[model samples]
Target: MASATLFHDVQQILTAEHPDPFRVLGMHTVSLGGELRLVVRTFQPGATAVSVTDEEGAEVAVMECGHEAGFFEAILPRGTSAFPYQLQVTWPEAGEPALMGDAFAFGPQIGEFDLYLMAEGTHLRLWDVLGAHPMTIDGVQGVHFGVWAPGARRVSVVGEFNLWDGRRHPMRLHPAQGVWEIFIPGVQDESLYRYEILPHQGSAFLKSDPLAFTAEVRPATASKVADLTKYEWNDAEWMRSRQEGDWCNRPMSIYEVHPGSWKRVPGEDDRPLTWREMAVDLVDYVADMGFTHVEFLPVMEHPYDPSWGYQVTGYFAPTSRFGGPDDFRYLVDALHQRGIGVILDWVPAHFPKDAFALRRFDGSALYEHADPRQGEHPEWGTLIFNFGRNEVRNFLISNALFWLDEYHADGLRVDAVASMLYLDYSRGPGQWVPNQYGGRENLEAVAFLQQLNTTVRDRHPGALMIAEESTAWPGVTQLAHLGGLGFHLKWNMGWMHDNLSFMSEQAIHRKYHFNLLTFSLMYAFSEKYVLPLSHDEVVHLKGSLMGKMPGDAWQKAANLRLMLGMMWGHPGKKLLFMGGEIGQWGEWNENRSLDWHLLADPLNAGVQRWMRDLNALYKREPAFWETDFSHEGFEWVDFRDVEQSVLSFVRRGGESGHELLFVCNFTPVPRYAYHVGAPSAGRWREVLNSDAEPYGGSNVGNGGVTETVPLAVHGREQALPLTLPPLGILILQRED
Candidate 1:
């Protein structure tokens, strides 16, 4: 190369502005006097002198300072070829000279095929290709770092290994793939790192790795190097059963919990329980409660506690707030071992505006829309993902699989799905952008969701993809190939809202608002549903389930038991947020533990007992779940008793001949002889009564048995004249 060109390249390396540092800063063959010669170049800013050494640590040649900024170069003896080498440097103030491998010495670590997949946005195992992965390259052990930053002038891996200096370890850019990578030998796991990106038009700034598997606890935003392959999981049986079992026909009673507030150590400043601790305490609690699964609010790394893990920053990491990534895996394994499935609340709807996160990454709207109308979320003060971008879609889809594949999560309850389905969500007219078809729908997001569901369904046969969508979007739980959203289940938000509203009305007014109680049946079988009494209803001063009920404390307790019974007996899967089962009076607070002391109160204890018994009975009876999404599973005997605020229904297990009758009395008034339709004409046993004394009710119900008379009623061949409890529910099954 010409002397002037060499000087300019050396200057670019010193200034950290070289787009491709590998070409000018590493060993290369150059022409000298019409003959090719091996030349080695390095940049060590603080070194007083530098020497090139062979693989055996023998000094090969003393390098001369090619620039005043500590640029060093050496010409090897003629006839030499490129071989393994290191730099031995002498510092004026350091006690000893440092010997280190040249970050630019290695060739591109990311394979061309992987790069092509990444560019195509079809890299299913993106985490494996992009991120700080500790591996052995060319007989040398080091950490290989890769990131996508197409618009950046330069990208460097800045970490403690390089004294957090971008100039020390500028990465090599693969121009065709828009990926930058460097294999920094001696960089080990648990080291903190960030990417220093020099945008095309502005100053350079450091951003956390988008594919970090573990991150520093909040209040510190650096990404930590983690080894995901080390965790030895012991849930083989659980995984196998999960893959083959038919989850839709099985009973799934989920106990939703917020890890940070579920329980806290009073003696330790009320800090939340760690993952290992929860592995024992929370696992035992959920198991004893008879819940089939435990759904955690997002456990992914997030900075704001108030957002309740909804505003995600780190997509691949399990939050370090509880413990390391493996600790979380241990918790999941523990749950699986206890015969409990785990569902993680995944938030791909939006992300916070933290500077160190994905915001304006690579000095462009790489992961989000550049236009505010399309990129911004007004209500959340967050940023919407640009689903149209292939790489962005890949990032999210890959993240969803990461939890299910790496963490062994049985399902993912996708959060704020309604926000992603529409372009004008939570927006007024003129505040949003329309798609190419000029419709309110977000076509890109819809396509992304369809692809996401299809990929998850194909990859994990039995794992669930549940949507927490609140809109009236058709076919949410239908098959994607049939023009549906392809969700295994969707939360029945309409049922929750209508029922809660009815339950809150006074007994006198409940009769007037009877439709609220029976209106859900009209569309209950439209989709596979999970009737969720989730955290959202209990937060933001919406009040706790207990507080939402009308009348005195006794009536409130009875009402809560009745509500729970209705939810379980309804033709849908169930999910109850923590604190609801215990009749907690206060709304949920993310900052503190649940009111555990409420268990001391008999009413609260009774509510808890009622929930446990309800779950036990629900799981034992396939009638409640076997034909959940089909009208065949549910038959309304009578919803016409509106004047008395009563409802009666029969749930049947198809072909199994298993049947259960659910009769609910919404008002606090006992009826001595209310005739209810029976499915058969034999002995019917009272399997569960919410009004039993054990559940803090008046105990007004049949004495464990009722005989059906041959009289016709509600088009059935038999009828049962039974005593109806006040504000209570009774579930009866035929003995013969």
Candidate 2:
């Protein structure tokens, strides 16, 4: 070695240890014989000859091989100023010479302001600055790659273009912000890439980009460069109206669906439906059913199909199993055009411990906590996110906003929120650690949820933030500024559990468990609520909703109609799982399609017809949904009929003149001439009856109209004689 400094720099570049390769490997100025000269250095490890070509393709200097390891250099004359050049290299036994652009020729692409904001953890649009973004820089077109791996000794962009060689494109590190960025001249969309991170200790490993907009199909993990701006959206009207007001008082009947199993190709190996296919089929099917929205169980990318999208790997990219990222955008746009909103199931509670993903991301606990008590979820065999870390918080919050802003999602139903809120969740006394205040609540997670809700509402007003929180958390739907979690709606888990429990008993035994059906009203108005008969209820051998009813097949179908009617009549939004509408007998299995053949039978078809009518009636009549979150919207007419196993209630619409009365009989025995209180002395119309013949029920009900008499009953000045059908619910409205 002629110079010690040159020898050290060459070794570092060859060993892939140089944190910043631009200063040492690119063109530099040096002093020779008391005169300044231009020196060009290149590290083509396998090249036999290398030359520096000028801007006009003229050879300026033929580089001399300085080391047996393909280190080449050339120094120009003192009078020869620095000029734009390219590299022309010849490989041993190669047929022709190759010309290539120097990756280090470009300067830093990220702005300084973004770096500062990222360091402060306030960069809301961090996605724009990080990840693989294709752009043109200084008459050169390529991809700008950025990543956060503060703990790594060195990081390089490796892909098929670079022959998976780390020495080809070592990134420049921003030490203060812990970000590594570089402009790779000529990398474009559809290029598969991953980060080759050299940890400060141990062996190096490959990682898929955390902010990857799209990923290759599973069994082959690599990030694909996708241009999100190319897709043209057509949901202007929907977006404009969505931002105008809150959706609390609106009709929200959500049909929860798992896309992969919802529908499959007939006789074609059960192939899942593509996003484009779903757009054409699912959007219209849900529209025809009169559902206002469709809530998909986590559609984020995951390696295991059995996880049912719950264990997420690619948070930003929709699962490639359906289609490309643009395909997903098309699905959203199509649904929006049909006046149906989309709500995605978001899994921020925990993530699976996949080796190629976020686990030990930087050879350290970068995204999760170091201690098992704080980081690991024993029940799920997954890792819990470190909510207290600024970078981790930034990652999750940005992901939440990404779905809303980029994908045009109308709402987020955060899954397993109870797991995130409590430290002792599913754990024994000695196995968990409490917060600093010695409480069971995870304070950091609580703060993170508050921040997540606040940011989503402040930025995207009228967007819903729903929590699948099971416990009795205080004020889950209240505003954050008023000292609450700031969710727009919380799942009424208690109601679902109690209702199913009581409905499963025999008709004669239901009277003893009568309170199970009416106990939810005790605190129904405590938070904005959604009565969810979700996927969880039909899985894990819990049996289908129809199968849970204790009766013959005919009675079971009638009971399902009764349950659906009761859900709509209750003072809350409604969410029904996919197979529940058609009396599906089998429990939910994510591997296969729902039993679409069930609809061929009149018993099942009638249940489906009943569900469709329920949605139509629920949306049209404001009394069913207008004041769902307030105590004033509901009043108990009669709940003391324990021996008969019957109940009655009144629901009020926003208008003073709009009101409805509901009478329910839990048993399979008709009650004739049942007296129920009415609000006004007028004719009442029997608007909806679960015992109708069309809904797989025996025709047992009063005629369409009943006259109310001016007789005082149950604090109401009017009373009406009603015919309560067996295992049925009756909805009566005032005749105009």
Candidate 3:
């Protein structure tokens, strides 16, 4: 299959890396045929996929790439871009496609060189921030509106702007380059507009610059209007939750929740919660659960229909999904009441259709950028704010602070940190640009993130800032002073990835990869981390955590126990999505609420009980908390005959704290008197058991045996013999 709609004459973002044969990234011209039709694409390589969108004021186009399109062959034609959209190659057997840095787009253009690697940069200035209106006091006219398309034949800046007609709106076209540029000196405060690209150079289509700061609807769509702003938040002075000391990267038994679907009782009228109503109910639940914190998917104002709340239309307003802006404030306050911090999943990475929001809140390049080459997120058609512009920087920075300070959120889990770091984060080479200074171009985004962390921390000491970074962009979770991104905590994505991979494999093969269980301990070397069973795993393609396991009900139970045991014992913060505790049976649907009824059954109920006990044990045991123990606490006692499916480890508390040893049998048969190495010689007590019949596990073992059992070993102190059951976790404590 080939790309039916082809692109031509593509160009690249100029940089100093290569003076000649400049690599081509994107094109300067996009041809959206008459009726201003929308173009879309979906990048689905699995049963489920990540489909990007496009939104510019009144004009919009969204299309999903089908899973049937074959792995890389499924380009849903996202939206028209100004560059040569690279061809995505698919590999079904590999599970996913590799980033083949090749240039492919809508037009006939070739990249002159490799670009994603070249480090190009520039000094950040004031114009990049959002909501920044130029001060024309006394006559110093700063940056103004422009009717420009350097790559087009003719253009005009139109909106609730300089009149509807093309009157004072004519943009000048540089014939030599077949483009246009016109600046309106007097335009500044309170404005919204978009560039209308004319059919130039043998083209018969109208285009919307993906980088337009303000967009307007030109008919033939469900929405078309210039957006302005009107919002009033009273929580600006709220102090964020603690970030350091007692609260710094502690056990994060996060109750991952999607506000829209958390309590939605299937047929009920969409789980309605009045601000005060939810506050009263939810705060009680968090405190009772023993979880340290709670994470809410993008709570900032967004279009309500979106299930995951990923498509944000209002960056500053809290979603009216459940209630109003102040209602969200009440929700945060409720969390604080329970001694639990709330984490807001921020979407600074993109925005949806809310012309009344960011669509050119001011004049040209007010909230975004003037050129698609700089302001567009190619994959997610949403208008990507120009992180390089001063005003745009301020807009995003201030937006971040607004949630932290006003809403009193303890922290923010910045979405898509990978996108913010790389110039061509997901693009094939030539699609990105750097400043005049020569660096990996999105330098402004990085700097702003640093500033955001620093500022948030300075304002509130214990303010925890976490990063959802998938890419190993060195120092992403490091402190700003160390020249890193300054996030207090980062998602241990490697663990999630490897663990999921291991869980998906048959138990017979899992033993061979025992290293995956303990290797992520390496994450402790950099910034603090949080092991999150995020919504990503269970909802779509990857399948629910339980569904990924390979075995019968009993084996599945054991598998879960093993995974949960490792998660709890691991050295890092911890979190769990809403229904994961009760063993949700269905896939995570963005539309429906969590399947709360699953808890009604004895089997699922058992999983929930085990989770509670784990949390209790984690808190009661000092080995689970405190930083000094990281280096000395966790050690794999045995992985011998990993192929047979057996693994064991002992976690010793630091500063002379209590010690606990955990052993597991991944195989299907029971093993008697398993030899596990222990650090001290003394009585060992069976403190916890995952084989409890209540949790859907067989009662194949004895627990609470408070008796002395010691063995001598040459290394440190000794090893001990303990009974083991297949697919079960046994916790023994040293009893002197």
Best by TM-score: 1
Per-residue accuracy of model 2 over 339-362 as CA lDDT, tens digit each: 999999999989989988888887
**Cα-lDDT of candidate 3:** 0.58
**lDDT for each of the candidates?**
0.92, 0.90, 0.58
Write model 3 residue lDDT over 1-736, tens digit each, in one string. 1334221211101111111111122122233443332233322223233322222122122223322432122223445443222233344466762322121122211111211111121112111211222333223332233222334434555545334433223344333322233334444543455544433244212333322222222221111221122234333333422543556525567888876666654456665455566687667766776777789888654544543767665555565456655567777876775677788898777665354345443323445666666667788776676776543555566667667655677778888888777776667657667665766647777888888788777766776788998867788767798898888888888989887787767877787787787677666656577888899888657677777778976566577777887778777778888877777767788777677777777777888788878888887787776552256666767766576677776776666576787777777677777666676777778777888777777777756663434555324456666667777788888776
Looking at candidate 1, what is the lDDT of residue 624?
Answer: 86
Regions of model 2 farther than 4 Å from truth: 54-58, 77-80, 91-94
Cα-lDDT of candidate 2? 0.90
* lDDT score for residue 498 of model 3: 83
Give residue 169's error in model 1 in angstroms. 0.9
For model 1 the local lDDT of residue 511 reads 78
lDDT of 1 by residue, 1-736 (tens): 3588887888789899987789998899999989999999998887899999987778998998887778899999988878999889998888787888887788887899998988898999899999999998877778999999999999999998888989988998888878989899989899999999999998999999999998999989999999988999999999999988778999999999999999999999999999999999999999999999999999999999998999899999999999999999999999999999999999998998999999999999989889999999999899999998888889998998999899999999999999999999999999999889999999888899999999999999989999999989999988889988899999999999998998999988887898887888899888889999999999888999999999999989999999999989888999999999999999999999999998888899999999999999988888988998899898999988889888999999976879999999988889887889898888899999999998887789999999998788888888999999999999999996
- Candidate 2 pairs with clashing backbones: none
Say which prediction, candidate 1 or candidate 2, comes out ahead on lDDT: 1
TM-score, per-candidate, Cα-based: 0.98, 0.97, 0.67
Single out the weakest 10-residue window by summed lDDT for candidate 3: 9-18
TM-score of 1: 0.98
Clashes per candidate (backbone, < 3 Å): 0, 0, 59
